[model samples]
Each structure stands twice: as structure tokens, then as C-alpha cells.
Target: MAEISAVSEGPRTEGDDYRGIMRFAHLVRADLPEPALAVLDGSQAILVSTLYPDAPATLQELIAGGSAALDAVRAAIADGAAVVHELTDFTFASAVLAPPAVLAVGLNYAAHSSELGLKTDAAPTVFTLWPNSLTGHGQTTSWPRSLSESVDYEAELGVLIGTAAKDVSEEDALDHVWGYTVVNDITARDIQFAEAQWSRCKSFDGFTPTGPVVVTADEIADPQDLHIWTNVDGHMVQDASTNQMVRSVRTLIAHLSQSLTLLPGTLISTGSPGGAGYSRDPQIFLRDRSTVTVGIDGIGELTTHCRILG
Candidate 1:
């Protein structure tokens, strides 16, 4: 299993600073198109566009060069030598395929808890989602009717750790994040009520749909101030603020790090807000052909098409 980790080779010397490094390294000869981080079948590749056609660079091959690989991709964009291809032209796999573990939270919102007839726990309710549950953007996710007719959606903000974090303070937690993305924490409400554990119901195949894109940490000034919402079949279902979170991102990280070693590339899907389909006035479960989109004000919107199987 390949994971994205920091290459600890020491910082680049003066001669390798941003501007000087560009001169020292090879640059893309012409402007072809924008580049994307994509996976072809199972291997990671750089999705680049050329006048002739589209191309991909194995992520393993790119990372082999360390920082130089990122510089190459940047140079390719700066040179305008690549052609832009519609991303829809390709299929996708989970963004981070072998992430150490997928940590999820529950009952973080008061309303969601009340609606489900569950009380808020004094401590944060945390659990794990198996790696096999991940699906990609624009993909159709199906659930077994016998397993759950109460499958519901939870709009959440997903955080990707960039460094090994242990016993970090709240002030320092954000510093360890690589980037942020949107995740739909689709839940099987029936299983949630029947089982004491959450991992199974939530870890069914294709239970977690993440991404459209990951916005680098630098792009977000305040992670806790974003607006998070959800739409079911073109109707808005959830509308709330990240500020309403029972536990802020920094605090959650600091708290989690105190007990476990958070490795680089670890994905933490923060708990979702209220207005879930399972607890609606009429009770709205994701039906076959239902389209659900969970969005964070600045991060991005993630849409998933649902399917129910007999």
C-alpha cells in the first residue's frame, strides 16, 4: 500500500529556494494544460493534457523525485505547454487509497442527536471506517435494501494530516494538516440503531464518498468558520455552520493526538450537522436515483448519486 509521506531530506539550501530552484531544474517546454492528481485503475498518476492527447505520470514516479516532482508539475503549468482536458473524461478511485485509518465522529450536533433519540455523549463519539468504503466524486453508491432502508447522509468536512502529529496543542494542530476536502458520511440509520458499533454500518462498500478536489490548508484561513450544508434530490436538507461543531478541528486533533500517533496522510472526517434525511418531518431516506450534494462554503461541493438494490 502506497501512502503520501513527507520526504525528510532537510530543507532546500539557498541555491534551491523557489526562484533559484526553478532555474536549476527542468521546466515543462510548453503550456499543455492544467495537471490533476488522478489514479488510473489502481496506480497514482499525474493527469496532464497535451496537444496530441491527455497523459498521466505515475504518482510513484512523481514522488520518486521528491520535491523536484512537485516542481515539475508546477513548471508544466507555468509554461502553459499542456492542454486542459475535462476531468469528467476519466474515472476515479479514492483520493488517498491506503490512508492509515479513517477516523469519524458521531453525535457532534445537538439537533442530529435529538432527532435520532440519542443524547450527546460527554466525550466525542469517535469510530473508524474501513478503507474499502471509499468511493469517488460523481460515482453512484448503492446500498442493500435488506441491510438498510434507512441509509442517510451526513455532510462533513474531511481533514488530511500532512505530518506525524503527537501530543500537539490546539494552536499547532492546523499546522500539521496537508489540506481539506468534503466528505459525505452516508450512514445506515437502521444498522446504527440495531448495532452498538458504527464501523460496520458506515463501512459498507462505497459508504464514504469524498472529494471533487482537496483545497490545500493554506487556502483556508479559518476551518471552523465555513458553511456546511446538504441537498437531497435538489432540495436543501442540512444547513449549518462549522462553528456549531461541538468540538473544533484544532481541539479534536489535539485530543486525538494525545492518545494515538497520527501519521501523515491520515484522514479525519469531522462529524456532520443536523437536518438529516432520517429525521426529517416525513423522514427522507435516499431513494434510488436520489442525488445528494454536501458542500462546505469555501472548500467545495461533493455530489453523489444513490442507488438501492433489492
Candidate 2:
């Protein structure tokens, strides 16, 4: 794994003094065709490419460049390279616009498993989410009513791997993590229950929404301690801590690495906690025009608007 430099410890301020150590991605305009990597300093965003013309254009590129590339970005920030924009000036793209794969873990949270009448498996229930499903914060996600009306919301913590790993130990698994983000693992409950497989039901276009921003792993002291929650149509639907995972992030990474080489920029959506809409007493499914927001305490919140088309 690339060595992450120590970020200055202090309260983040506005203007130039802003901390540039934490990297995020956003589209400067809604019309912009691609996401640009930026250094988030307070309410401002400094475009990495703009600060240094030779800098990487996307997060994937930056990660591919390793620690030295990141160090260059930090150095540019510290030197006060003046081109900065207010965060409000741009809209967000998925924090992870592109990745090697989007791997989701299921039955990794006992509460979620028990509530859904499913048993915790001896091995992690893993599934792939198609790339077409990926969307950004504040974007509207729609599905046809004919697809089945039982669409549900799941608030999960997303983990991004910075380095490839093969047969890594749980004790050293976290070293490969690049950062963390929030994920709204939207699901078509009816399809999910009906099918023997999970990917298609959950991989519908726009079903997996991620990020307002991705915070580097160095910023997070303990992934297990973060508070994760979800709100749908203004009501708190799912609230839990990362501590509830049946398999810790470290355990999941290590376990996964045992089977295959986990590539850099791979996104792992750790299982959601209990309180999924599918398991609610009255059953709270996402309805037409509904809005949902999933958030983690330190990481930014991700919101998605829903449109149920006939």
C-alpha cells in the first residue's frame, strides 16, 4: 500500500488555510461530462488537475499514481495554489465514478439477516452490483412499477481499496483501504426474494447510489465506530453503527483476499444494518417521488430522489 502522509491536525478553516489532504470528487457543473478529483478544504474545492496541470483527472488515476502523486497534491495545496471554487458551485458525481468492481456483502449484519428471516451464512453472502447502477448524490433514480413495487433502502458504509491484496491477514487488511464513503444500497425487495441470485435484483440501473464525497482512510480513526443512518421521505428509517457488522471491514477484506486478488479501486459495500424497509413492521418501501438520504457521521451524506415510472 502507498504511504499516506500525515494530514495536519486542526479545525479546518475557509479560504487558503483549508486542509487539502482529504481528496473528493465532484462535477464542476451539472453539464460536465466527467468527475474531477479535488481537494476538499472546508467549503471549498481545489481542482487537483487545475492546481497542477499534470495531476490526475480522476480518483482512480490518483490512486493508480500511488503515494507520491498524493504527496504532490498536498504540496500544491500547502503552497496555496489559488484556483479554488466553492463546493456549492459544483454538483457531485459518484465518489467512486469507476472501480474495478462493486462488491456487496449480505448477511454480514446479524440484525439485517434475522429481521429478513434469513440466516447468517457460514461464509459471507457476496454479490456484484453492475456499474450502470452507480449514481451520484442528489441524482434522481427511477424504476418501473412493473418491476415490482417493493423497493427498499439500505444504508451501508463503502470501503475503497488503495492497493491490491492477495491472501492478506485481517491484522493487515486495513492497510490496503484507501478511504470510506456512504452507500445507499437500494434494492427491489420482491425481485430479491424471488430470485435465487441477488445481483440482478439489486443491480438495476441507478439502484446503487454512492457519495457526496469520499474521505481518505487516514482521516478515519476507527471505521467500526462511525454512526450510519438513513432517512426516507423525511423519516429516520435505518440507524445503526458500523460496529454491528457481523464481519468487520478488516475481516471482510482479509477473507476476500484469500480467494482472489482484490484490485486497487475496488469498492466494497459492507452489509447494511437492521431496519431495512423490507423488514419494517408496517413495511416502508420507497414510493414515487420519494427522497432518501444515507449518511455516516464523518463521511458526507448521499441522497437520491426516486421516481416510480409505470
Candidate 3:
């Protein structure tokens, strides 16, 4: 089993009340054909499928099921009907599996934009990360050494939508959010600069590592106030706040919904902050056996091991 950790949970509200924030993850073991969605209880997990026969099997299903499904799961927990599983018994799957899409915003932070010599366009610098790149915490991510020796690490905040929004107002934007998770938007710097677009360079297999757990949106007081940072091989590199984003989360959602509907289970990786390894005096890129951890305070942390295959 890979190392997994869960944040401390708070008091559960009364029956059928889904107001209380809950942490969720997708757990996998050899016996289970598919990943099982579980509610994190400290370091242990209670499989949501075991909570009720109709409960969702994956995080995507749960998001699509809406509030009624969440209420039922909470009701089951409050009833003490949960069957707990040890965290050590299974490794993690991506917090989000088969999301409708993985939308990524680039250069949302002025510092990051400045550091990379890119300008934050009047509209957000948005792109897509292929689903093939999505992996989970404590997983090993590898790429051919020939691809690039300049791969970089970016720590970002990831938001999951619970409802569809075609053209929502900024004020109503946050309501569509289901939860938040940490994302390490691993990038191949050389390919990224050489390419006309960002998709291919960053979409290599196992490049995007998301979640040990997803902390419900309600638990996060102000997305802008949280602390987000990165540590590469045990050394602090990137450190900043969501406050620095050129556009807020609600702004991004509202802006995105204008052109196309932001569907349920869609993950919006809200871009990274200032300290990219690329901008450091002596650029620090991920190497074989390197461990990189990206975290959002009170939200969650994700760790990815790196390998440069010949």
C-alpha cells in the first residue's frame, strides 16, 4: 500500500443534512475491479458504496447524482451504517476519474506569468489537460528522458463542479463547485515553449497528480485566502496564496460558462503561483527518484514520485 493521509473531519450535522463538509477519495485494491469512492475518516475510509446499495461507485457518479445523493450518504454515516476500511489496505486512484473535462488555466498569477515570460491575456489563459495524465497521490510518474530534461513542477488548486452552468454570474459561480483538491501540473518546459499550444507538452502519461482527498467546497471559507505551495524533494520551492490570482475562482467559472456549459464533474485546475523551478537561479527540475508534493492549506496535499526512463 502507498502512503495516504486524510485531513481531520469535523462534526457531522443532523440527519439528511448534507451541509457539513466531507472529504472524499477514490480507493483501489487488487480485488476490486474498479475504484471505490470512500469518505475519508481520519486515516481510515468508509466505502460509500457500502453505505447504501444505491450509493455512487466513483467520484464522477456522486457529482452527477447531486445533493440528494450526498444527503443520503451523510444520512448513512450519521446512522453509523458505514463499513470502515483501513487506508493501508488500498492505494489511491485520481480523486476525479473520467471527469467530463479537465480544464486548466495558465498564468492566472502575475508572478507565475512574469517568471515564465508569458502575459496573462485579457481573457484567462485556459487550456486542457488530457485525462491520460490524471493519476493519484503517491503514484510514480515517468516520461522518456529524450522528451525533455527540463520538466517542471507546478502546484495548483483544483476545483470540481457539481452542477452545470451555461452563463452564470460571478456571485452564483461558487454554488456550482463541489469540492477542492491539490494538483501538481507537471510540465515539460522545453516542449511547452517550443509548442504552439500547451496541451501536448503537459499531457504525458502520469503528468497530472491530483488528490489524496477532495475537501468539500463548504469547508473552504474563502478560496482566495488559502495558502498554496510546493516542495520538491523535501525543499520548499513555490510558496504563494490564491489571493494573487489575476482572476478569482468565481470569475474563472463565470467567464468559462459564457462560451460553453461547465458540466458536472469537470475539474478546473486554477493555475499555479510564482515559484516555478524554471525561474529559479539554478532551475530545479524533477529527476529520477525525486519526490514532489503540492498542497493547499486545509484542502489536501498530493505527492508524486518521478522517473526519467531512457
Candidate 4:
């Protein structure tokens, strides 16, 4: 992904006046030509690049900078250095603009496995989601009717890695986390059943709608304690807690790290819980013009608008 610098060009000031909670997202406004890294303070957004000319232009760069860079950013915010804008004025881009990889876990919830009539593997059922599937909150995700009619939604907790982790212990796993976000792992049930590999079936363009925002790890007390749910249009379809996961986030990370180095900015979408539309008594696939919002408490809600082309 291309790095985005804040469009504001003026005399810089030391950010000492602003003092509040700090969240982050990539934002695009009508006035700006590209999405820029923004530090969110409640309903307001502070342009990160404007705080310092050398500030990291993307979340990946910021994660690569490690704790020192994060400290500098917090310090800059405390110093009140950047131009602040109301968040309402800008549209959100994907919370993770350019992760090194987007890894997904499947059947991590026994209830989900049972509902779908699929068995939970001895290990996590891992898969990759192609980048093209990634869309931002409030964006539209379209697919063709020719593809399949049984599209479903999976509301999941997304973990963002802060440090390179390889062969890490479960106790030290959370230490590598940068933060957390909500992910809607949209899927095409027919295609998924037809194919042995899952990447393509789940990786259709705009299949993954990521964030309205990403909260730093320090903000969340326990990843497994959070409430996760899905609201399709107005109905609460999938309601569950992260505590129900067959495997904890830390265990998943530890297992993944043993085989390969999970680099900074990697997003691991811990699997969704039970109550998927595919398993509904009468079924509840995502129809054309449907709007699905998936949320995890402490993180943020992510919404995706769908369109089915004939």
C-alpha cells in the first residue's frame, strides 16, 4: 500500500494541549486526495504526519517503529501538535490499510463447528484472505449472483501484531499484540463447500470489511472477555462472547508463531462464534442490498453494505 502523508501544510506546533484517549484509523475526507493516518480522540481526529514530518505514514510503519515511536506519538498528542478535525467530517478507510498478511482462524468455536456440521480440527483451521477483499467501514461489498447465493457473515475479533513473533510461548503471546479491531469475515457458503481450499471462496473482492477503528491493546483488559455480535440490518443475528472460543487468542498466536514469524502489522482474525446464517433454521444468507454490522466491545463496529449482481 502507498504511504499517505497528511495534507495539512503549515507551521507545526508541539502537541501539548490535547490530552485524552488515543485510537487510530486511516481516514479519507472530501478535501484530501488520499487516506491519511489519523489519531482519534473521541469524535476528533489528529493528523499524525502533521505532528512530525517524519511520522510514520501507515499503521504498518508505525508498528515497525515499535514502542519508542508509539511513545513519541503519544507524547506529540500530549503536546497538542497536529491539526484536529471532527471525525464525522472524514470517511474511514480500512483500520489496517496494509498488513503484511491477513490470517484467519476457522472452527475455533465449537458451537460454530457443530452448527455448520463441521468438526473442529485438532489444530486451528487457518486460512489467508487476499488483500483485494479488504474494504472499510460503511463501504459497499458487491458479488455476482453467478458466484453463489448462499453468502454468509462471520463476526470475528481481529488481532493486530506489534512485534515479530516466532516460536513464542502462550504466556508471551499477548506481548506481541499491537491492538485489536473487528472483522466481518464474509463468505460464500456454496463455493466454500465446493472447494477444498478456502482462500478464494472467502477472498472474493470486498469480502472482508475491517474497521471503523482499531483500539490499542492497552485499552482492552482481556481479549477473550469481550462481547462480540453481528447485526444484520436491524436483527441481531449472531450474539456471543469471545470467551466461548475453543482456543484463546494467545494460544492461536503461539501456535502460529511456532511455524513462521508473524511480522508487525499482521492481522489474525480469530474465528467467529456460533449463530451463523448458514446454520440458521431457515437460513439467512446476505441478500442484495443487505447491510451487516459486526462489532466487538472495546474494539469498534465494522459495517459492510452488500450488492449482488445478476
Candidate 5:
């Protein structure tokens, strides 16, 4: 089994209650006859099949039991009948990993806003992350150190929507969530501070490292009550609570759904809490050989090794 950790809970699904959600800390690669949706729990990679191999991998698979697939897998897991495998030899890919769009929020935390010297918008500051940037776990994310030695990391709670939402009420917004994942919103801080646009700085190839795994929505009772943190090398650099978020996850979704259709399989990187490297007294950028990991109390910790080329 790869390392596993627990975090706080988000709201439970109506009529269906569960214990805390469990996410995989290791990478999962499937070797099957057809396209498959599988989750690695402990030492097993449980297969989740939708309509058929050719059927598209939709958010519904996981969200609507497609996302909830883990639930069934866990039943077998409890019975000691899981299909456990040695991941040491398997290649890995991003979890839920491929989504319709990756949306990120900016300055949702007061501390982050102050550190970046930016004013919070009366409405939420939202941006998109390109798909080309998605990378698997334990991968080296590098850039020209010259691109901006000010590279930083933002530990954020990533929400994977389960259903299509449009003009949703905050109370009902979370119902559309399939599960949650952690996101290292790795950033080029200098570019972030300099550009009016946010996508480019945050969307550099390999900047977003998501998943070790995705925990179902039913498992989390309250998304607002988790502890999020980051460590560089061995030092704790960023630490804060999800409760500090200016707008709760529900609120952010409600707001976004108002202007755009919040499609199923959308990955929303909620803003990070304070303690970004660029805002430190002496400043702490991700240096060569730097190993940075970001985690939420119940979700999982996402680690990325950094390499800066001159």
C-alpha cells in the first residue's frame, strides 16, 4: 500500500451516508482488455466499468456510482477480496484526472490576498488551468528557473463535480460534486504578481499536480472543516484551515454556475490559504531538488519534486 492519510469531511449525500472517504496515495495504472475506470485503495486497483470499454469516461461514472464506484470496491475491500496489485511496476495517470475543464479561484483567502498584494474581488476571482499541465504523482515539475525564480506552491482543495449544474443554489451546489482531490496549484509567483491574467502563470506545463486519488462526496461531511498545509523539504511553510475561505465551496460553485455551466467532471481548485513562498519575509521559492507536498486533513497529500533549469 502507498501512504494514506485522512482529512476533514464534507457534506454527505442525501439518504446515503458513509464513513470518512479514503483516497489512494499511490499511482494507479490499469492493464485491461478495455478502457477502464479503476481506483487504487491500499494494495488494490479496483476496476470500475461504465457502459462498456468504448463508452466515454464521464463524470457520471464516478459521480453516479461511476464516482461512487469506489463504494462497491470498498465492500470487496472490507471482505478481504480486493484485487490487490503491486503498483511498483505499473505506470500512472491523473485521477478523475481528465475533466472537462479545470477552474481555479484566486485570493479566496484573506492571507493569500494580502500576501499577493491584490484586492479580493467583490465577486470571486476565477481562472482556468489548461489540460496540458496535468501530471501524475511523484513526477518532476520543472521550468526555466529564469522563467521566474519566484515559483511558489498553493495547496488547495480540488472539487470534482458529479453532475452538470447551471443556476444552482448554494444549498444544492454540492450535490453536483462527485468527490474531492488535492491540488498543488504550483505557480510562478513573479508572473502571477506581474500579469493581469492568471492562467499562463499557473498553467505552465506540469504546474498542476493532482491526485494521488479522489474521495467521494458521501465520505466528507463538511468541506469547510479541514486543515490544509504544505511542506518544503522538511519545513512546514503553509498552514491554514478551510474554514478561513472567504467563500465556501458551495458559494463559489453557486457563483460560478451563475455565469457558466458548471459541467460534470469539472475540477475546481479552490484558493489556497496563506504562507505562499513569495510572500515570506526572506522569500522561499521552490529550488532545484526541492520536494514540496500539500495536503488537506482528510483528503490526501500531493507531493511534487521541483527542478529549476538556468
Candidate 6:
């Protein structure tokens, strides 16, 4: 276990008025096939790689580098020494590219549990998500109709752990949070019910679309008080608040930490609200060419285009 608190001793932020919390994300340029870490600056993106010679290349690196690396990047941004590019010139990537693990909660919302015909356990229902399922905002997610035609959408809040935490108390759980982002826990509904486990049903390639940006933990006042919702094609499908969650972010972290150390850069998707397409009067599914957007107020919106293959 390393020290959780680290004070930055590198180049200091030149101005106290730099403005805005550092919104971090991976940005992809046509020339650069791989995504690069960047800070979203209004209409521009400050490449973290160009910020300083030793800047972290990804969110996981930044988290591993701790406050020192973050402060250095902040200082470089405020010092105005790095080159920046138009925000529109580059496409977005998952705020979290790779993590130690991708944990998710299920039936955490009463409405979602009731509608899906599942029971919300006295303790949280947690599961693991595969890395292959992770994709960025504005990307296309396709599936073979032959595999499963009943794909569904779930709007969820994603939490990123900044430090290794074990057996943490509920009161201190939030201290380990690095940032927050949006996650659409897309599921194959028929498979979800047919299978004894939830991971496989939801872990298809590109099934978990996240990001656009990861707002630092400090930017979010209360994770349990934000607005979380979803839209399919053009209509609003799921609309609810994080307040509706059966277990708060802190509670989930505390409980999970009791079992093992949540390593740095681990992501915990806090589960979805009600209004799953499967539970509607006339059920809906992500059809070919359909689009879905799941968003969290004060954070960012994540969109995924759907394509169904024969």
C-alpha cells in the first residue's frame, strides 16, 4: 500500500485563474492511429504528451504518477507552453483505455430491478467487465443479429479509482476516487436472462461504451446527486437520478474494498436506472443504424451508434 496523499513539488500552475477542472480524455487524430491523452480546453485540446517531456501518456499512467504528474500537467497547461489543437480536429476515445479491472453493479436501482424482473440483493450485485467491451464515445458498436437480437441499453455512472484501497470505511471510500465518467452498460437482454452469469451477456466487444471526458473527482460535488439519463435514436428512453441508486458510490467502494485492494485505475460502473428498452410496453432494442446517448449532468454525454449484422 502506497501513500494515498501526494503533494506536487514540480512546476507550479502559473495562474490561480486557469479556469475549469481539467477534463481528461484520449483524443485520436487521423495521422496518429493510436489515441493520445489530452486535456479538453474549451474549443481546443492540449496534448498531455506535449505538455511536458515526462507527461503521462494515458489516464492509467497519470493515476499511477499520482498528484505530482497531474500537477505538472496542470502547470504546463496554465503556463501555456504546450501546443494545442482544435477540439473538433480530433475524435474522442474512452477516458479509460485500460484499467486493472472493470467492475460493475447490477440491479442497483429499484426501478431497474423491478422492471427487469430481478431481485436487488441486500448486498450489491457486482460483476466484472472485459476490456474488449470498452469503446469510446461516438464510436459504432455492432453485433450479429444471429448471436442475439435483444440488445439493450443502460445508462450508468463510471467511477475510476485513483489509488489502491482495501477495507476502506464508507466515510473514506470517496478519497480513493480519481474521476467520474459516463458508461452505457449495453446488454444482450435475452442472453442476460438465459445465462447464469451477467458478464458474458454484457461483455461482447464494444458493448460498454464510455467517455468523451473524465471529470476529476473534485469537479463532482456529490456522485449520488447527479442527473443520469439515456436516449435512443431520437427519443428519451431512460431518465433518472443517481439519487435513485440502492447503494451510493461510497457504499459500493467501501463494500468492495473489504474483499480486496481496488488497484489504481480500476473502474466501477455504478449500475443503471429504470426504463430499459426490454421493460417497455412495446419493447425496443438497438436496431441497425440506431443511436444511443447516455449522459451524466456536469460530466459528459457518451454516444454509441448501433449496427446489427446478418
- Top model by TM-score, which number? 3
Q: What is the C-alpha lDDT profile of model 6 across 1-310, one tens digit per residue?
A: 0011222223323563456658898888778868899777445566788776878999999999998888888777777465656444567777799899999999999999999998999999999999999999888899999999999999999999998999999999999999999999999999988889999999999999888889899999999999999999899999999999999999999999999899999999999999999999899999999999999999988999999999
- For every candidate in turn, the CA RMSD to the true structure comes to 9.3, 5.5, 3.1, 3.8, 6.0, 6.3
Give the CA lDDT, 0 to 100, for residue 265 in model 6.
Answer: 96
Taking the tens digit of each residue's C-alpha lDDT, what string does model 4 give over 19-100?
A: 4355788888778877888887555677888777699887888999999888888887766445665554577788888799
Quick one: ranking by TM-score, best first? Answer: 3, 6, 4, 2, 5, 1
lDDT of 3 by residue, 1-310 (tens): 2665543333333453334548999888888989889887567577888877788998898889999988888778887555556555589888889999999999999999999999889999899999999999889999999988999999999999999988999999999999999999999999999989999989999999999888888899899999999999889998899999999999999999999999999999999999999999998999998999999999877889998999
TM-score of every model?
A: 0.78, 0.92, 0.94, 0.93, 0.83, 0.94
Top lDDT model = 3
**Whole-model lDDT per candidate:** 0.70, 0.84, 0.88, 0.87, 0.75, 0.88
The alpha-carbon deviation from the true structure for residue 118 of candidate 2, after best TM-score superposition, in angstroms, is: 0.6
Evaluation by TM-score, superior candidate among 1 and 6: 6
The clash count of every prediction, one per candidate, is: 12, 0, 0, 5, 17, 0
- TM-score between candidate 5 and the true structure: 0.83
lDDT: worst 10-residue window of model 1: 20-29
CA lDDT, candidate 6, residue 162: 95
List ranges where model 5 is wrong by over 4 Å. Answer: 1-36, 49-61, 64-82
Better of 2 and 5 by TM-score: 2
Query: In model 5, how large is the Cα lDDT of residue 88?
Result: 51
Residues 52-110, candidate 5: write the lDDT tens digits.
Answer: 33322433345545544555545434554333344454544456556788999999999
Judged by whole-model lDDT over C-alpha atoms, candidate 5 comes out at 0.75
